[model samples]
Target: MHGSAASVGPAAADTPSRGTLDELDLALVNALQMAPRAPWAQLARPLGVDAATLSRRWARLRASGEAWITCHAAPSQVAHGALALIEVSCVPQAREALADRLARHPQAMSVELVAGSCDLLLTVATATKSSMTAYVLALGRDEAVTATRTHLVQHLYQDGSEWRMDSLSRDQRRDLAEAEDSAARTAAAILAPEDRALMFALAQDGRRSIASIAAELDRPESTVRRLLHSLLHGGRAVLRVDTAHVHSGWRSSATIWMSVPPAQLVSAGDELSRLRSTRMAASVSSEANLLSVVWLHTLDDLARYEAQAAARITSVRVLNRAVNLRWIKRMGRLLADDGRSTGFVPIDLWAPVA
Candidate 1:
C-alpha cells in the first residue's frame, strides 16, 4: 500500500496457474472493475476472502504481469482534446519495427498490429485540433507505411471502463456498488494543479492508498484524499483494472466500422455497447459513422457478434472489419507479443506532436 505500481503494472496474475485466469482471479478482477480503489477489507467480504489473502493474490497476479489496474483521463478531464483512430497500410518489411516505434509515442493511447486491410491501427488523442493535424501529417511523412486513413471520434458511447468480467454474483456486485457514495458523482470537472499531480500519480497505480499518495506528495492526507475523491467521483479521471489480453482467454480484438442512419446513430451506439465483447463504441467521422472495438475468444467470434449486431440494430451496415492481431501498446502500457506488460508510457493526452 505504501509503494507504487511502478513495480508491476496493475498487478493481478493467473490464478496460481500457468495458462489462464481462474474463477477466483476473475472474481477479483470483476470486483476491481466495479470499484477499482476499494480497500482490501471492503473488497474481501464480497469475495468471501480474507483481506490478507486477497492482498497476497493480487501481489502474485501483479508480479506475473497477468493483470493490473491503471487510470486514464476521463472525458470530462479531456473536454478540450481530440481523439481519432488511424489505420495504416505498412510496408511488410518495416511494419513490425514501425509498430514498436509508434507505440512509444506519448500521444498514442493505443497502437495495435492488425490483420485484414490495415497493418497497424493507432488510437491517438491530442490537446487541440491543430496538434491532431500535425500528428496526421507527420504520420503520412513516415516512410514505413504506404497509406493511412483516419477516423475522428465524434461521440464516445462507451469505453473500457464499462467492460467487466462476469465472474461475481449479483449480490457481490450490489454490495460493492452500495459502498460507493452517490453524492460524489459529478457531471464535469476542471483540473487544478493538485488535480494534475493526482491524476499522474493514479495513472501510475490507481489502487494506491490515500496515505501512500499523501506520503509521496508530502501533503496532508486529508488534502490528497479530497483531491483523489474529486478527480475520481467528479468524472475527471477513470480507474479500471486491465489484463494481459492474450493470457486472459480473450485472444484477439477487432475494429468494426458500420454505417447507421443519422436518426438511429445514438441507438446503434447504445446497442453496440450492450454486447459483452464490446471494448469501445463510438460515433465517428467517416463513411461509417459508428466505430466499435471488441474483445473476442477467437477470430470466428466476430461473425456471431456481427449477426448479433445486425439483429440489434435494423438499419446498420458493416462497412469493414480490421482484425487486431496484437496490442503493441494497449491504452498506455507496452505489451510483448504474448501480451505481457513490458512497461508503461503515461498517456499525455495533450502532448505536442513530435
Candidate 2:
C-alpha cells in the first residue's frame, strides 16, 4: 500500500536532529518503501538482518515519528475528483493559524509553509470543478489570505506513491516488484462505502492488523481480509511509509513548472518520473502545465538537476521553480517543525461540502 505522511506543530527544542539515521536504518526504510506490508521474513534475507530485528527496528522508527506508513486513495480514485495545487499568500502573522485551519479541512491533502512567491502551498482534492472553485473563492475571502493561485492537475505521472528509497540493490527491488505484481493481480472489485471506511481506518495506520480493522468495523475477519485484498490488488488504495527528507540525504525540495507541447505531455511526464530526484510529476491546467517536485542534497543541486532534466526532456521547457521551506502538513499527517510526523488527520478528499 502507499500513502503520504502528515505534519503538525513546531518541533520541540529537544527534537532529534536528522543525522541519527544509521546505514542499517536507512536500508530498512528503503525496504519498507519498496514493500510497506511485506512480511518480516520476506524482507529480512535481503537486508541480512533477522526478522525479529527488522520488526523491532521498524517499531522503534514508527514510535519515534521518524517514519510511518498509511494508506491513501489510489491515483484512480484521486482522478475521480478535481485536484489542484493552491498557492496562498497570507499575512505573516496569520500564517500559522491559517495553516492550522487549512490542515483541518478534509479536502486539503497537503498544507506547507513554503518560501518564494507564496507563503503556503496546498494540494487539494474536491469532487468537482464547482466545488473546487467554491473552496478557492472561500479562501480568497479569508482576511488572512492575501492572494491565491490554483493549478488544476490534468494528469499525475508520479505521486508520493511512486517515490522510492533507492537504497536497495537491483536484485532486491526486482524481487519485491514481482511479489507486488502477484498481489496486485489477485483481485479487482469496485470500491463501496464500507471499503472507504476500511480505507480511512488504514489511512490512520497502515500497519493496523486485520483483526483490529475487523473489530472496529464490526465485520467478520474473513470479510475484512477479502475487502483489504480487493482494495490493494484492485489499485483502489496504496500504502506509503513517509520519513523526514533530511534523514534520506535530501535536505531541500523544489517545485519546477515546465511548458510542453500537448502531444509531448505524456512522454515528458513519463521521463520526469524516471528521474531519481522527482517526488511528484504531473500535467496541470496552466501555461506551465508540467509540474514536478524534486529533492536535492542542497539548494545548489536544483540548478544542476534542472539542467540535466532539460537536456534529457528536450520537448519540455522550464518555466519557473519554487522552494518548499517547511512542510506544515503532508498527506493528512501533521508534522513537527523539523519535518518529523507528529500526528495524523485522515484525508477525506471526497467529503461532501455543505
Candidate 3:
C-alpha cells in the first residue's frame, strides 16, 4: 500500500520544538496506526478519551506535520510491477540537489542521504519491466550520478504498512485487529478510471472529506463515498499515517541484506517481520534473498540486533547493512534540514517514466 510524499521548502530557521509523547499520545498514534480511517468516536471509546478531544489532538498532530495519514495502492495492485532499491553514487557536492530532484519525481517512494557505499539511496517503483529499465537508464545518464546499483524486490514480507509503535494494550490491539479483519474480507476488484482519480485525491490526504473528493472528481457525493468505501474495505488501497520518527523517539534506521535457504525463506521472513525493529522486510532478486529496513532507538542497537539476529534466526545469515544517515524523503514527504516534513509529492507508482 501507499503512504505520504515529500514536499520542498526552505530549511527551518531553528530545530522545530521537540515535544514528548505522553501515554495518551502514544495510545492514540498506535490506535490510528492500526486503523488510519477509524472514526474518532470508535477510537475514543477504547482510549477512554472523548471524541472531541481525540479529534482536536489529531488536528494538532497533522498541522504540526508530526503525524498524518495518506493512501496508497494495495500490494496486489503493485505486486505485478517492479520495485527496486537503488543505490546512487553521485558527486558529493551535488548530493542534496540530486536527492531533491529524485524526491520530486513521482516514482521515487523514498530517498535517503546515507553513510553507505552510496551517497543516496532510493526506493523506486515502476509499472513494468521496460519502464523500470528506462528509469534506471535515465538515472545512470544523469551528469550528477556517477554510479548506480539496483536490487529488484522479489517478495515483500513486511512493508512499512505493518510497522507499529506497539503502544496499545493487548486487548485494545485485539479489538482494532478484529475491526480490520472484518473489513478486509471483501474481495478486491480492478480500479476503474474514476477509482484511480479518487485514489489520487486520497493520496494527498487519506482523511480528506468525502464531499471534497466528490467535488474534485465532479461526481455525486454518494458515488464517491461508495467508491472510497469499496477501495478501502475491499483491499484495493492501503491507508496509513506517516509520522516523524524523531517525535516517536525512533532516532536511527538501517537497511540490511541477508541470505536465506530457499526452503527457509518464508519462515525466516515471517519471524523477522514480528520483530519490533523491522520497518520494511522483503526478499530480493540478488545474492541476498532478504532485505529489511529497521528502526532503532540508537545507532548502537544496530550491532546488537545483527548479533542477536544471527544467533536466533539460524536459517538466515546477515550479509551486509547500512545505516540511514539522513532522510531526504520518506514515503512521499520531503524532510527539511531539521527532519520535519515540509511538503508532499504524491507517489504515483503506476505512472510511466517521463
Per-residue lDDT of model 2, residues 1-354, tens digit only: 113334333244554454567788888888887777778888888888899999998776766677788787777665666889998999999999999888878788889888777899999887667888888998899999999988999888888876877777888777667444223422234457887899988986787899999998999999999988888778878887788767667788888889988988898899899888898999999878899989888999998888878887887788777788888778877876666778777777666553
What clash pairs does model 1 have?
10-68, 10-69, 11-62, 11-68, 12-61, 12-62, 12-67, 13-61
Residues 1-354, candidate 3: write the lDDT tens digits: 233344433234443445656678778888888877778888887788899999988776666667777777666555657889989999999998999888878889889988877888899877677888999999999999999988999877778876788788888887777544223523436556676788889885787898898888899999998888888778777787767787778888989989989988887888788777988878888888888899999999998877767776887788777788888888777775545677887787667676
Instruction: Rate residue 224 of model 3 by lDDT.
Output: 91
Stretches of candidate 3 exceeding 4 Å from the true structure: 1-16, 175-190
- In order, the Cα lDDT scores of the candidates are 0.81, 0.79, 0.78
Give the range where candidate 2 is weakest over 10 consecutive residues by summed lDDT. Answer: 1-10
Candidate achieving the largest TM-score: 1
For all candidates, the clash counts are: 8, 15, 10
Question: What TM-score does structure 3 among the candidates reach?
Answer: 0.91
lDDT of 1 by residue, 1-354 (tens): 211113343334443435788888888888888877778899889999999988988877777777777777776544566899999998899998999889878888899988877899999987778898999999999999799999998888888876888888989988899664322323555566677678777775678888888887999999998888777778777886898887778987899999989999999999999999999999999998998899999989999999999999989999998998788888787776777776777787666677
The lDDT ranking, best first, is 1, 2, 3
lDDT score at residue 9, model 2, on the 0-100 scale: 30
What lDDT score goes with residue 235 in model 2? 83
Q: How does model 2 fare in lDDT?
A: 0.79
**Cα TM-score of candidate 1:** 0.92
